[model samples]
Target: MLIATTFSSIASAADETVTGIELSYDSWDYNTSTSSLEVFIDDDAVIVSLLAATSSSSTKKDVSASATWKSSNTSYVKVDKGVLTAVGKGTATISATYGGYTQNIKVTSDYVYDSVQILKNGSNAAESYDVSLGAEQVFTLSGIKSGASNENITTNATWTSSSSSVATVDDGTVTLVGVGTTTITAKYKGKSDTVKLVVTSPYKSLALSPKTLLEIDMGDDDQTIQAIATTTSGSTETVTAKATWTTSSAAVATVEDGVVTPVATGQTKITATYLGVSSTIDVVVRTPYQSIKLSPAKEYQMMLNSPGLQITAEVQELSGNDENVTTQAEWTSSNLLVATVTNGLVTPKAVGTTKITASIKGISRSIDITVFPSVTELTIDKESIDTFPEKSETLPKVSGNTFGGDTADVSKIVKWTVADEKIATIKDGKWTADAVGKTVVTAELNGLKATFELNVHLTPVKLVPSTKELSVVIGKDLALPTITVVNQDGSEEDVSSKATWKASSDNAIVVNGKVKGLEASKVTLTATYLNKTTTVKAYVEEEIEKLVAEPSSLELYPGKSKSVKVTGYYVSGKKVVLSSKMNWTVSSSTLATVNGSTVKALAVGSGKLTGSYQGKTLEIPITVSPKLKSLTLSDKSLKLSPGASYSLKLQANYTTGNPVDVTTSAAWVTNKASVATVSNGKIIALSKGSATIKATFDGKTVSMRVTVK
Candidate 1:
């Protein structure tokens, strides 16, 4: 019989009775009292556990084998015997019933494939892939599920690339487009994955020989260049024959393959491109010469019908080497009538100066050529000379006159001889008088001759003074008359040094070729040379009665100076300058300092200077003004071009005076002579730069900035 009995007879068995069902999962939190659970799934399936809680025991018993599990939606989640599997991406309820108790668990299913992976080559997983430029790569996509084998989803997935220019992907195939980085992605059923892709160029950099600049001479042989590229693997390869070559200007230079040929004298750019990398070099096609020079660097002299002079031309190459091009140079003459040149050979035709030039290519050098006519006449500077015995005299200089009216000194070239050796002897253009006799000398040059007469042991017959009468001021000296002697040969000789002098009056005396006046009186002086004698009269002037200074007054700034003039008036209405003979005195030494007749203002003050000559005195009033108040320039700043000149006016102002123009007198200086040069307040711009010009006058200085453009 089926009978229900509420019996507490088995108390021990009742204490172990199941009270509620508990659900747990390693990835989710389950509540025993709440009777529900929620779980997040990253994989397709997971193991779930069920437990039974006893009323009298704290420990729970595993009831997974005894529990029955059910899924709300078969497409979202499915469960069987405490095991749950995710079918799709959605949320579903999983329930377990044990011991008459049921627990509902919420399960959110992700994509059936937990992750998408990219496989390279043959099933090898890769996070990043590298492909060559203009190349292709095949990538495979796979689905990954937890606790399950990975599945190939390459065909069923949508493939995309981050940058199509760098890489393009279709299905599982990836094509490299450029040399950059891009991301490759595959998406399937809400599951997406990515892989970094780098499409690289085979070459890292391209380099060309003569990397900086290539210089070639026009009409010279072509230059061969080599192009090399560095690979991504840190290896070098030669690509000279494979590089595409181009030039900026074909007229200047042209390149084919790796050969560079100069076309004209100009500049161009040569570029070499290999794959996606390029390199360029500047090319210059110009003359190979730096400068040209000609032998016989200075002016040359030649005569008509003379042998032609061969001039040599030297060209300084760009490599700092010199080359001789005498025969290759083209020679020209400015005046063909004077001289003619052919291949650096100069031939004179007439007597004149001509400019001769030797040129090679475009460089040239010039020299002046002077053609002279044949010498026709010869002469000496002195034809006759009188001297005593045992005295030596240098022979006269010899001169040659050309037929073309040109004169030249031919002293060293002329041949000189003496006719009478006993009377005189000649050697090295010098003549020695040996005896009391006369001799004849001859000089010859270029078929022309000249004669020089020499007289020895000549006696003086009479003495004549240069002056017969003279006047001397009192307490002053006058130069004595120059004494001359008439020789026996009728030649005059100056014997002032050997003559004896005497004064007739005691008031005037001769000393050191000068006549000194001690008193105011007329005196007579005599000079004798050997047996000849001469006389002269000297008159002394009286003392002055009054003295006067020129200018009378002075106005000067400190550090400035002026000169004073003193004139004495005699009793006979005669006046003489006594500036040097006067005794000077200043009223204030602190205000001014006097040096002879010049007075320099020392400080700002007023003073008077006195000059006493004999018994007469002159006074000059001087006022030393303050230092220069200011200095102003017409332009404080200037802007000018090269080779431009501008006149600047500098005006100086003082404490008590009119403005003075110090443009021409001020001291001028330029800080930068290369940029601008200043002289006397005039500025000249030299080049493009800046400079400062300063002007100083009367202890004051002012400056102006200049810009040369």
Candidate 2:
């Protein structure tokens, strides 16, 4: 009998289970209930035959897969009839069920390919291409794998054109049909690449419309032309700007971007050429005007009731032909009371200006005539004065011919006015500069105005600083607050240390560029310069009293040393290490000595080691043991034969009554080295004689006699 059982366990965040199936041929989690499959684009389909089984008699056997295949998100990964395919880069839940048994396999698809390169005309394309309109190129798509070989995926990729109207692509074939630009994209799974294409028409021949061009006006505006380009297929298009255009004579006319401009009155040919085909058009360049104008002397100045000056005028034709029509033209003045024009002569009757109109061939143009004063002259006490806005000066005491002719002050009659009120204000013969710049000031009298430019600038202003607050630790110096100086032109400058400083309370003080904390209180720190003052708050903290040198007592061996540490405790229960800054001293130099907080043992004695810092002192008792009270030889006398050697042994006895071997370290001497020589704790017998051996260590010595027989 065939039986079905379901068993599951919580795997990671969610519960995924496997039942009634044998899961093998995998590396991770498939047999345990939670399994997933990973694949990339263009990957082979995975056959799920492992999920199929059948029961017969007393055994289960592998059978054809009859289970239905379904996917959670078909866009990511999908399965059809037990075959799984990857569509895009994402995850999908693929489930299969048959005969009351179900199994799930999460499939993840990823885009693993790195890039795609295009192959044009059966070869790899190293760069983009430009094709003519109606041309075609067979483009095969290639998907390049990262760190691997390039793959020809033209048949497997989907091809698309960004601009369908300009070009079209089908199965990797690109066909250009219009004169435009477009990008061809090749996609394989989720990886895609694009190549830009520009389609241009094959130009054949260039032709100009009307076989002529109209003359251009003399201004910034340019006139355009019409150019038709004919192709070899007998098709014509207006490719005016696409063709290069040139004038036969630049002195007569110029052409640019299909625009032709007339430079002088003449006839010239404009030629436009494209792709080795050229066409020419004859253009007449001329100006269009109504009548004549007088040159050189547009305006004439004449005294009242006097003969005027004679002027000349020139008339041009539609063909740009000029003629002197000065004597043939009739003239008249707009203001007859001020001036009169007879033929080309203008006579002034008053101190004013008149418009003189000249007519030729019934076409009219005007000129100007002015009359000056005969003897009047204007003078001023000051022509131009350099002053600021704070000072007020009267309008120039302008007097006209003060002694010789028409002697009278004309300052009031002048009526001065400034051109720009925002720059300077003028009222009742007085002016002020509102802004820093040069302004035009005019003095007018009897329709005559004289203009003068006045320059004004702002006065320099003092510096101002932004406010700041500071907090300092007890017995510490802190940097002063930043100060900025307000410049004359209303700008700022950093002058933190340049300003004079003062404190409101004695609890804190300012010195150099820093503020010193005195007592635990608040004080006002002020910075002043050039009548400007700015204040800031200074907060000072109190001193801490918790200084501790641990292990109030210590024991050390003779000639041995230890490092002493000193730490300060704050009110907030914080510790500050001060070993390097404290002064370390021992009561007796014979017992111990300290160098940089390290106490060295000198003798077997007790002494007081003191550490002093900032009005506080610390004392600790230090004792040195094993002081080497005496050094003695184990054998005081020895008898040896000639050529016999004996090793010496020495011992040091300390004040603590401890004995130690001082053999190799003890200083040894032999009074008669010929009899017995002591070297490195060993004595050698040389000849038959008596010798004395001595050993010394730690200010103690011992002697022994050796006899060689």
Candidate 3:
């Protein structure tokens, strides 16, 4: 078998001068004197490499892509850039030349099969296979040879099916034609193999019904359980009679062919098994009802001609479980003139007393109810009032008038709500305005509603500043102006701390009426309160000549990061750090990435970091090196089977930040290339032996022991 075939790394030559060359496959040297190239027919394509040795070094280099390749007999074998493929069973000569040097190797291609076998799903050896209805199964034909490698001949073999009506075979691919058993045969060269195949439902699992816990009342009819067999094709069939049914306790329940009969008042488990799949359910048998009781055991008082209340009837079962039988029970009222009841719903018709009864399964329960007269009209003290934001006031007093000409306070009992919460809020008889808006406050009681219009007014006509002009030096704190909001109703309010402040330029910053000078320039400041804005002129006085960045240069390893600080020097000997106000960028994104003033090195290269402040730009040269603090392999040791390959990852940890993946860039070497060879961190096991793999990068070295068997 061939393993680890990746062609992305091929078709490339080194920049070194070639002096001599040799051909190899899987790190195994090919000899043209005595050994001949042996290849199996219809096997995986093998890659041959041309290793060149330069005059300046003793080590051999890969020059396969730069070499010219040919096969003497194209019918026997085909060579494409050192990749050899067997087309027919014959002998051929493979030759490669590079830099006036040529090498030739003899190749022999044939199917040396000692035995033929059938594989299921490309791997496991099987004597029989199953194909679901409306589905297909692909069988692999493996030609195993003694003292030689095995090859897959699925496409090269001739396929035949014993029953064409049940299943059809085409190149080891068995297609289901009907539901029956068929024999599949594969003929490759002079060897043949056969495997039994069944085309049917291909049952996957068994589901039993009913799925819930079976509850049977004493003296009730017998219940039947069902078993459903689901196939792999998502088709289901009833197999209750075909399944094996058993009961856990025969004293409580007896089950025969999915039919269960309760024998006593107890619980038992019922199980059904079909086609190697089984499902179970709990069976419960007991006396259903012991006694029934109404939800409200005492008398209930309600208002007359109001909304009705639903009374539930709960029954205590013999199994110690409660069941709500409100709809199932029969409900009635003792006095129809006072109240009426239907389906456990009781409604009061008059101001009198009545008894409500609910009966279920010959068990009865009763509750006494008293109805009171409802209110006629609801009234409040005041209709509406005005308020402002952040102001609270007490709500109006409410009274309910009854038919008997009596009145009572209903302020606390009434439900209050505001139409718009953005305007105000009323809770516990206290109203507080949140913003300047108009909304209605509604109070509801006894099916009567009372609404009042509330208008929150805070309209500001003009904004006035305490100061008209201001001046401050760079790196100094600027004095902010106090603002006052003048309302339209001839009223004024100071809003210095509650206004949105902004500056027209980067020379100064204003937050909540606090200002700080950033550069030597003049800017306009504005303060806004309730949509009324006022302006003020501010001057940031400073004589700045140039800008400078600390640590004129930067040197960091890959994956390392740091921040650059920018400062401005004034001609008056005043210096200030303006890192946040400076716009930063990098010359090459492939070398480093800049976020604000922070710079992170990405790869090994040289670039320039530029920062522009107040029209003055400064460049800081940056150098990224591949100097690693430590290097290690992901696996300390590895064990692999013959003809198997594994990719090893090398982590290069730097002095700062996280490690980087340098697997493909590191130099890989193996002590025994014949046993195991490594290319760009991928190790391929050629034969059963041991080898040591080493990786070197950035003056750091790490090794791993590999045992292939």
State TM-scores per candidate.
0.25, 0.23, 0.28
Candidate 1 C-alpha lDDT tens digits along 11-89: 2234466666677676343434543333334343577778777676677777788777888887877788877766667
* lDDT of residue 568 for candidate 1: 77
Clash counts for all predictions: 0, 3, 0
Q: Model 1: how far is 553 from its true place, Å? A: 55
Candidate 1's displacement at residue 512, Å, is: 27
In model 3, the runs with Cα more than 4 Å from the true position are 1-17, 25-35, 42-47, 73-75, 114-178, 185-192, 195-222, 225-709
Task: Indicate the TM-score of model 1.
Answer: 0.25
Tell me the deviation in Å of residue 592 in model 2.
Answer: 99
How well does candidate 1 match the true structure, expressed as C-alpha RMSD?
Answer: 40.9
lDDT of predicted model 3: 0.80
Residue by residue across 342-438, what tens digits does model 2's lDDT show? 8777777776778888775435678777765443666556555554455566666765552335555556446688888877888755887677667
Q: What C-alpha lDDT, on a 0 to 100 scale, does residue 129 get in candidate 3?
A: 68
lDDT accuracy of residue 67 in candidate 1: 76
**Residue 129 lDDT, candidate 2, scale 0-100:** 76
